[model samples]
Structures are given as C-alpha cells and as structure tokens.
Target: MQLTIERIYTKTVDHDGYRILVDRHWPRGISKVNAALDDWAKAIAPTTELRQWFNHIKDRFPEFQTRYLQELEQNPETPAFVTEVAKQLQTTNVILLYGAKDQEHNQAVVLLQYLQRQPAIQALLRKE
Candidate 1:
C-alpha cells in the first residue's frame, strides 16, 4: 500500500486518492467543506487523556508511541480499519491526514509506521 502522511492545513490542495483524517478532534480553523477528507478515522486516535498528557511535548513521544501502539492493538476499530484501508489501497494511494505541526512526532507518523508493520498491510505492500 502506498501510504503517505500530510498535514491537514497545508496550502497544497492537490491530494491524490483517498485521504483519511486520523485526528480524534476536529482541527482548529478547518472547515468540513475545505478539508476535502474522504473519512475520519477517529477511533484509532490517541485517547483524550493521552493527548492531554503528551501535549505535543517532543520529549514524551517515545512513551506516547508505545502507549499509542498498545491502544491501537487493543482498539476494536483497528482490525476493521486495517481491512478498510487494505481495500482502499488496492485502488488508490492512502493519505493519512493529520493536524499536528510536528510531522515527526504526531500520531500520523506513528500510525504510518504501525500500518507498514501490520501483517495485513504488509501483505498488500508486498504485492507491489
């Protein structure tokens, strides 16, 4: 699967294929009409408590990644999300859209890595 990450607020508007927002809460100053999102996978986003604790602190990223991975594995929506993404990937490139300014430490980055490692996702990637 050709998965990529992009900040939601970027000025560039020419996103190709399916774009899914991976944020739990709607990002500030963005409207539904302009976001051009195909889906919002909020179920897999970090919990409110975790998000508040992390507070975008770069130092907390490591622990946050671990905790987030655990949450992804335990989350009921993960399997179905994987399946849906796999289905979509067969037809288009999947863009993981996020609102975080820190491209390196945000959930989208972690999620892209995590998705790359998933057996189901990996199997599809191998086909290419």
Candidate 2:
C-alpha cells in the first residue's frame, strides 16, 4: 500500500488516490471544495480534550503519541477506518491529510504508524 501524509494547506493536492482528511475540526482558511478529499475521517482524530492538552507542544510529543495511540486503540471507529484504508490500499495510494504545521508530530503520523503495524496492512504491503 502506498501511504503518505500531507499538510492540507499545501497548494498542490495529490489526486493519485483517496485523500482523507483525518482532522476532527475543519482546517482554518480552507474551504471544502478546495480540499479535494474523498473522505473526512473525523472519527479517527484525537478527542477535543486530548487535542487541547497537546496543543502542538513539541515537548509533549512523546506523551502525545502514546496517548493518541491509546485513543486510536479505544476508538470504536478505528477498526472500520483501518479496514477501509486497507481495502483502499489494495487498489490505490492513501493520502492522509492533516492540518498540523508540525510535519513529524501530528496525529496523522501516529495513525500511519499504527496502521503500518496492523496485520492487514502488513499483508497488503507484502504484495507490492
């Protein structure tokens, strides 16, 4: 599966495959029409409280990643999302779009890592 993470604010959109916005809140200054998204997987995003607590603080990134992974594990929508992504990967690339400025520390990064470790995704990767 070809999986990639991209900032929503980037001028160019990758139309090669499914573009999923993984943010709970709409990105500021961006309109829906311009997002070029196939799906907005808001259910997979961090809770409001967790987002607020993290606040993109670099110092808290380690803990934030731990908490975010825990949240994903407990989220009811995660299994479905993972299944959907795995299915999508069978045919095309999956672009995980996020609004975070920090490229390395956002929920999308965590989610991608989490998805990579899943058996379904791993099996899909082996086929390529």
State TM-scores per candidate: 0.95, 0.97
Summarize candidate 2's per-residue lDDT along 1-128 as a digit string, tens digits: 59889999999878898999999999999998999999999999999999999999999999999999999999999999999999999999999999999999899999999999999998987898
Q: Tell me how candidate 2 scores on lDDT.
A: 0.94
How many residue pairs clash in model 2?
0
Model 1, 73-95: lDDT tens digits are 99999999988888988988899
What does the lDDT come to for candidate 1? 0.91
Q: At residue 27, give the lDDT of candidate 1.
A: 91
Model 1 C-alpha RMSD to native: 1.1
